[model samples]
Target: MSLHESVLCSTLPSQGTGTLTLHDLQTGTPLALFKHTSSSSRCVAVIPTRAGLGGVAIAAQVDKAVLNVYSFQKDQVLLKCVLPERLACTAVDKRGLLCAGGTAQGRIYLWEKLASGALCNVWDAHYRQVTTLAFSHDGDALVSGSDDAGISVWSVSRLLDGDAQNTPVPLLNFSDHTLPITDVVVGIGRFPSCRLVSASVDCSVKLWDFSTNTLLTTFLLPRPISHVVFDATERLIFAVANGPEGDIYQVNLLRRRDDHVEAVGGAGVNDIIRLGMENKNEQDPASGKISVGEEVTVLSLSLTSSLLLAGTVAGFVHVYDVHSHQRLRSISVGAKITNVYAMLRPPDLFGHTSLVAREGSIPVRPIAPLQRTRATEWEGKEVGVLLAPFGKETAESLINYPSDELQRDFALLLHTSPSNVREEPATATNARVAELEAEISHLRGQLGRAKGVNDAMWEAMVRKVVAQEKEKNNADEGRIKKKGKKDH
Candidate 1:
């Protein structure tokens, strides 16, 4: 089946029967839909599994104490497990190794090696009800926010160290905001380079570098920020303010005061961009922004398509172009959307959780159900869970490998026929194969420009490396000549 480059998922919270829907990132086409009773704000996280199908989403159901693991490809709930506490927000690492949830009582619960619930830890990570939670880029740290206006970064490695007598304290804590925090976004950088952006009811967004344990910059806005989101590149940030006539604010991380600042309309800060304000950009209708009303509940961004999704309480999701400030598509979901998650979905993954092999496709492995690690008296306190690998693993699906076989395969496929070179007798299989071949042909037609850019970048990097090596050789030769003259 042909799938879009990314998937946009949202859940209805206030309806009599909660609904979960996944749509194409750009066209807003429904990919999958199902009825799910559990819902909450910031409740769903769709992650990419090793298997190509829709990776499992860790969804926190508000009406009940259990969380539902939904498989996007299968369009069904994989598992529903009871939680130790009532969770308000939940997050999973990119590797799907850990599942973190924030409880209404202001505690953070982490299940490490999710398949083996054995590595469970709970800590009082906040003062009031926890509002949001996010895993750091490397998944080595977890960032949690609470209604008490506190943001804490917890070290995952240290927590699992298990040598300490008591629970470990957070790696760092920022108590700058005075009101409840609505959302937090962690960049894909480690150590001193890592940045954490947060929005709160205090009408301000603060950027912090956890490594130095200090605030980097604060962007004060006109109204309270209801949601904050970072694109895949993290170059731009989208922060939505609450209330009627609320406009979406765009903040550029790479920009400085030196920039011309022509794109934004009367921005309060050089780095913070004010988008789509009708009063200021009246002459340029395209410059004007969409006035997302107070009822807007969920906001998700697709960097691939440069589209911003705004889900409102009135059961409508409006897609707006971030660059042109034009509304692209509006989807009427017919219910209040409380939880929404947008992610890049990989192609041709497994059809189900069973890891059944399909023709001309590879199965992306899914994480197994949560289990406990039992400690025996003989082993004392050090208990470890061992994962015995059992699943379909394709040689090409492996991201990290020492062999250049993938490069060779790419080159070989260039001359290969567009259709599956293998002849098949079945009509349904042939039709599916033909459809895939046409999709491949269409993609290759568009890949020329992108492929050129990609090759240019690679060649440029290779040339730089070659030049550095040449310089090093020249320096060594000059040193040898000087040494020989000294010896003579």
Candidate 2:
């Protein structure tokens, strides 16, 4: 009962059918397609069970309020558990002993796996609809994100250790986002200091130091980010923007510009490096140009960190080579791809392969353990920098100063008039005037070029309007002729 490497795609069927298809990653062939009686079942997470026997727990939303857990083994559902809540998001622990889900009413339910494939000890958590969830690699903490733009870190041990009747408080809480959180991933190995990354419809991704409840950095994107995943090394973040023309972008976490403010509160702004654009000329003519703005609904990263999978609302799954930024293949599942999971074959232990895992095999870089006192000291400095004024100089002096001498002299001696100053050498003054005149001429040339572009754009718009009017008139004339023929 060894689990093989595969990809699971949950689809929204066009004709009142919902399906969960398992495809072999090597051959891109469907191994099995599990069709549901309900038309809108969206399979969310495929997690390995902890029962010593190789099995998978498939969580799917059968409807708005009912989540169906199908225990799958050898391409068949052996057991089923129905959770009575409208679940919006779910996550399973690494050991598969516990499962967490967020509901529409902003409650979180933690279901511990029992001996006979039953889920029990449901714990209520959160005050808003949970939108995303992730389990820390060590399986000690569970992180949940909700529509309230809040993230809560729950202790796994406390939830399972204490009485089921008591509601556990979050270990840490974060509320930096102003919109619904779209995805969350906990850092592992090198990032063992409890680092969490979250993406949101606010068009920003934030890196949080969960140990101290402080935001380390924020990455802003052009459009709302719907999904985010860490690369194999955890040094880069791959995110999918939400829109018809939404693109996949790779953000380098370690790279920061020198001009970037290193303060905690002020985030460093960097451009998203676009990746994996399929060549339009090489694609199928029938498919056209991928529709102008098809939204990317889901994203998954391969275990090797070399490949990326993006599922679109247009019913196409695009595979990309991460390093080359090229689309390797475009799989059309004939339905909207709601979710995609990359199931990596587990590493051989004592010559026996265990269950599958989602993360890659790349070794994590060793990062020094974060010091709490150092972090606190830096936070104070950041606040000081944010609150500090620009300078003591007047606004006019600050605005007019162009050189070091002017900044120092004019700014300090604001009461002194410029006309009373000593004159410069005649040649130097002439040279300065000439330089200023040359700059003005160059600016005028740029303005002329800009005006030309604006005029061209205006003319194009006018022509388009005229063409639309002509088409409407032709349609009206055709209707009038048809009416005359009928009257006759």
Best of the candidates, lDDT: 1
TM-score of 1: 0.69
Mind giving the per-residue lDDT tens digits that candidate 2 earns over 357-433?
23312111111111111121222231101111365332222223245455344432332455655547689989999
User: Each model's TM-score?
Assistant: 0.69, 0.60
**Alpha-carbon shift of residue 397 in model 2 (angstroms):** 79
User: lDDT per model, in order?
Assistant: 0.68, 0.62
* Clashes per model (N, Cα, C within 3 A): 10, 8
How well does model 1 score by local distance difference test?
0.68
- RMSD of every candidate to native, in Å, equals 16.8, 32.1
Worst 10 residues of 1 by lDDT: 371-380
Error of 2 at 400 (Å): 75
